[model samples]
Target chain A: MLPNRSRTSVLVFLLPPLLLYCAAVLFPILQSLFLSFFSWNGISDMEFVGLDNYVRMLTADDIFWRSFFNALLYLAICLVLQLGGALVVASLLTSLRRGRELIKTLYLLPAVISTVAIAFLFVRIYSIDPVGLLNQLLHWIGLGTFERAWLSDVNTVLAAVSAPEAGGSPGCTCSSSTPR
Target chain B: MKKLFRAAAVAAAAALALSACGGVGAASDPANVSPTGEIKPREISWLLSRPADGAVINIMKKLADDYAKDHPGFALNLITTPDRPSYIQKLETLAAANKLPELFDTDATPFAQQLAKQGKMVDAEKLLKSLDVYDDYRPGALDYQRFDDGSLYMIPFQFELEFIWYNKALLEKAGVTVPKSLDDLPAMCTALRSAGITPIAIDGQDQWPLERYVAYQPFRAAGPEFVQKLKKGEATFTDPAGQKTVKWMAELGKAKCFQDGFSAQGYSDAQNQFTSGQAAMYNIGTWELPSLATDKLNSEVRDDIDFFTLPTTDGSVTSANEFVSPSGIGMAVNSKTYDPLVSDFLKFALAKYPAEYAATGALSPTTTVQTTVPANATPLYKKALETADTLGAKQAMPWDTQLDPTTNGRLQQELVLLVQGNITPEQFTSTMDNTIKQNAPKFFK
Candidate 1:
């Protein structure tokens, strides 16, 4: 073991990091926990509801559960599209060494693009009109019969947005009415 | 010598931090109140959500600039965000950080009501009265701002209404007559589809349009009980009108009158479909007119575009068909702000809002001057206006207006399930009922 001087110095060196952790992460989380007790709107004095908000969220708020489960579903989809694809890609790149730099740049291109642009592009592609690129691709691939509104139809919205076929980020947000 | 230099450096750093905070505190200090109760040269901020070319923002800027030039004692600094989706999040962030601007845009969404209940917004009735031109505003526009006890909360902006827009050229070519009642919709939709044209291109991708069916249509078709019941808690959303609305929604989905992937298309996408001449009729609000009127739109499509008042159920009591909301977005002053000059700016803004709105190609909630009625405006806008007198006279809580965030979220998802054909209207209503049961018991009582 080091002398007592070494132990004291180590403790002193760790102090700043510990304080930063408590101030940033720990405090906010704890504050949220306490705030959840109240029925108060964010402004006025918070009234203590004693776990009522939690109870209501689970038992009565179907929207809350829908949002919750939908998020989980999305998370699962993301894992498959992102993690699974990345692994396959990394392995392929490792095994096939030629032209790897060009391929890597192409693959990463979409991930670097702005989200709003991606959303706008996909919107055009998924439009029901036959002129949409996705419909054109469907026609070219002999899947024209399956060409339908990729975004607007409630039936295909979730899965249509799943892979997005672009990059790691998925496009399956709640329908526009749900609000950001 | 090195240790002494290090100690001196640490002391200087500590002192600099203190001075920086002290400087900010001093700068933030309120200017002395003027003897005449006028504002003492100070910057008051207004946060709003309006797109870059939006007519309302242009009017607001002009009025603010004009006021600043004349008043000299006050300056109104306006901050705006382009989209509504991010408006609330940004506002909440500002509020939490104590960076709340003096005047900010707000809406009648339950979230806005939450902010008003928290006392963040100024009493708008009081503000209007202070201007001495309160009577100049079209009556009934302020109804949405009122709380459960009838205290006003938000001041509405768009003060707009929704209606149906059809392509006259397409209708004339197809030989399908304009539908005058809800019953006529079936034949209209069926005939249009049979002729190889999509009937009504709805933006079901966004759930708000679904409100056109669930909340607005029932009242339009059957009567106003749809809104009254929700307001009084005497009627549950599970009623026949509500169910009828949902059934119609499902039937429309099954009929394939909407585009193939409608659930994904947003407002703009649906608009584009009609504008491109790919669709027969588009369902939207008055706010869409500015974009629709642009020269970039398909010439044939633009000329053929015409509006129609929402038709009633042909013979139902209270089937009067204008759907108006004072709950969209409006500029709200912070309660903490107090200045006579700020009042002067507001006076100028409200007084010119009607005229400025017309200049910007916007319709106003205030009836007299809000609209000169676009010379080319479809007859529907004026027809819809004849029914505007009934606004706020008898109503119920709009679908998402009264619910807490959690419940509203459930409707957003489950409502999509209904549209997808995975669920029924009954299921959707039950899910919503369950949401209220689980979340808002007090309101139910």
Candidate 2:
């Protein structure tokens, strides 16, 4: 029903917002890309160098590379935990009818708590000695062989840190439960 | 015609948004000096890495108020956070946006050094000399805030000396005395366990405490020379002494000496347990004095808190060096600050800052301030001070503070792994080298 002139006016109106967005968000991002090339600290006059930060990070900084791999490992766990947990929980929930709300609520309990609280709770569960609830229960059930300090060591630190999201209790045993 | 009107409205909105990013107000103006050629009545915000409830914050606030009263043109905007990791992230985010507080506190951690290396903080040396009280701080504390090439960046608050805290009651019950050195610790642990009480209560989940434990052993075995060697790359943690410390950590786990969830307890929680007589011994630093003094323990339990220097490891009177971080929290000014006002502020902040600071927390970091400990500050803190006086150096940049960020990050993660038995002791050392090599080859070389 509008005339061609009206449509052109609409385009004109939209142009400002598009321009502003480009200036505010996109512009800074592009600026960072340019700045990353130079070794200048924030205050000094910036001189143009080429891809030095990136190159140094990759080739010269061993710890950076080590942490990056550690981060990648963490990311993989997150993906698996989020999707795998949802799928498994959904399938298990299908088997319940009565008290479905209660069970569902309990399943979602962790989702409602602060991450710090959850981290602490799991630490008690996977303590290194037979003192932890997990070890105590394992002993009671005659599965004491599986006990260890969940957070202290490097091998199981990642698993312990991510276990909460994986539908497992948190904390590493000998158990240095790490990653979280 | 309607479309044209819409376009005009959108343009107006865009213009408004663009302007919003500027001039939050004259309140935040970098200009607008007072009659003294300094900024008039400006409030400088400080971002800090300590909890608001922390003893340091309470003292800093009182001091800021006192300073403000003396200088009407200045005020402090104090922002504090308890979470260390998040605090660093927030600082980084603020940096990216070019918005930082006027002052703040950070540890000798690597990220702080990054801020200096990346040119975020003002050069502290200029301000330090201007303040005139620079030499009055415990000599090494100030140096800890500087970079190796001698660039001053931050103001240190205290000299932290790590050591062992023993429960006199529990040890007495086991008829065991505080170990004169590390060699006696294993025997003490065995005796305490046989007496039906744990020998130590370690907050193991906090990885840095464990790092302090491992790093100290090298110093114990080879004397302070090991610290120099470790810093210079001549020594690796795989050395027999370093392994001894690692094995000690493992043995503690095996001995079942820690509480049910020591790994999960936060820093305060673990210390509180030891103060309450739940654990016989705790290895920690000096900042715990205020908490230990005021803990909700009976006189008997409270009386039991005492300290011993980490014991000798090798035969030659080998005293394990305490993990002493150079100075405490540092103070820095915004570079955009007017020089005179900044200088005046520094002079005032340093002149009486330490005495008042220690008075607030029972920690007298000032050689000038004779801090009176409450009736109950375990004689250990006083004894620890004497030991600190004789430490190798007051100002060497701490390892945790000196390492580049990438290397530091790898160390934190791999350390968690090494202790978990994820890798053998040799592999632990090799992994450290490999990880750093992979991430930052130039710095190591």
Candidate 3:
């Protein structure tokens, strides 16, 4: 509903940022897509292979497929633990009458922590040789039989790694979802 | 509106033009040797993977400082990244951009061979020959840095021998004798486990330590040639040598040789386990001698520590003396950055390096130098140094360095699963053979 002159001024003001977005974001995506047609070892000359790279990745490479499935699994777990857990916590926080700020701060603590520190912390917790916290707790409860190396066991390793990713950011989501 | 559309199009075109210019700017000339250039006394950078406080870095820093005293404008810039995986990623990225510093550390892996082929790395053998210090290097140390074609492009700086360090008291308590052969290891593990002792402490978190275990059986069965051929796809994991190795690893797993959850353990954790007498054996290198063979070790386990050489196997092609003795990761000079000053500084540094490094109770790569064992060092330290002199010609080339990166990664993962009993030896062999067959040609050729 702006007048013609004002509308032109607004468009002029937005032009620089729009151009930057195209250059920074769109260009890299387009370049990567273009590079997908070639096989180059960064230093070597790029050789155009048409669709050979895509075909091999989809059909021949077992590791690629395995990693693809792992990514999907990670996404599913992250959705459940991050969004679902955040919703639950948000609902509980909205109901609380007092100490809600304190509880929220506690929940948000991990979100503020660096991922590397969190990863190291979890590694220690999952460790078995030095009797980590999880194992020690299990032993205290006489559930030592259930205690195993969470990070190393092939069965648990995927879920073990996923858990830290899921747990680290749930508080941010919770804070967003909570009623103001 | 029409004028606005035209203006937007012009802006977009200008942005594209700028991006193209940026791309052109990124395309650098290929690294080349400038043999006739004058010596420039400026700062030179060395990107290293060793610990900042490690003996190698400490000695190098001293040498650099001393060299700086003579050359007024010279400064040695040390960029250290202690973590291996991250360092490799950074190194490879810098290499791709043709921005590798004046000096950098690298193992003699296939990737390094590619760099050498590209003429990015200086020929270390030729450099040493020109410097008149070629013969001073230990043969084993020099051999470790040579490519399959016997081309040397990396300089060795440190020598280390991997050993099975054990607690004598724990072995006595378990009533297990020191293993004399590779096959005897499992039985020894069983005896130790039967006495409620953890048999071995391994830093499986790093994955390379477990990969080292994979190399031992093959080296004993077929000597170093098996891996050499296997890496090039001329041999395979299903071959007799590879089969023996896989089976032995599985047997070690069955015997509960390593501590429970060993793969989850870090280097320090594994070291602590052995030093605190919680584990009976630790397979580590001589780099650990400062702590393991010195009074710096825990007092309770200090007197009980001893090490044995990698044991031989039945029908072993390799001798007892031939094992995993590596001259650490080698340092490569950037051919693009090489000049007379760099060469002069190297000559000065290399001359002083061996004696200084040896004086710190660490093994230098030079044969002319001997490690001055600390006063607090145990007899075991002296014994290990003597054994280094009698080492055989053949060395157990680490598989992690020999195999292509992709196959090497897969092997490391599969090795963990194999030792964890998640995969059978047959499955491991088949998968690895198929992996090698697929990837070797791309890397080797």
Model number with the top DockQ:
3
Question: Per-residue alpha-carbon lDDT of model 3 for A52-163, expressed as tens digits?
Answer: 9999999999889999999999999999999999999999999999998999999999899999999999999988877789989999999999799998888888999999
Each model's lDDT comes to 0.63, 0.61, 0.88
Worst 10 residues of 3 chain B by lDDT: B21-30
Docking class of 3: acceptable
**Residue ranges of candidate 3 with Cα displaced over 4 Å:** A1-12, B1-37
Please identify which of the two predictions, 1 or 3, would achieve the higher TM-score against the true structure: 3
In terms of lDDT, the poorest run of 10 residues in model 1 chain B is: B23-32
- Which pairs of residues clash in candidate 3, taking residues 3 or more apart in a chain or in different chains? none
Every model's TM-score: 0.79, 0.72, 0.93
Q: Residue A173 of candidate 2: its Cα lDDT?
A: 20
Residue B168 in candidate 2 has what lDDT?
A: 86
lDDT of 1 by residue, A90-150 (tens): 6666665577666666666676677778777877887766468988888899998988766
TM-score of chain B of 2: 0.78
Report the CAPRI category for model 2.
incorrect
TM-score of chain A of each: 0.77, 0.67, 0.91
DockQ scores for all the models shown?
0.26, 0.15, 0.45
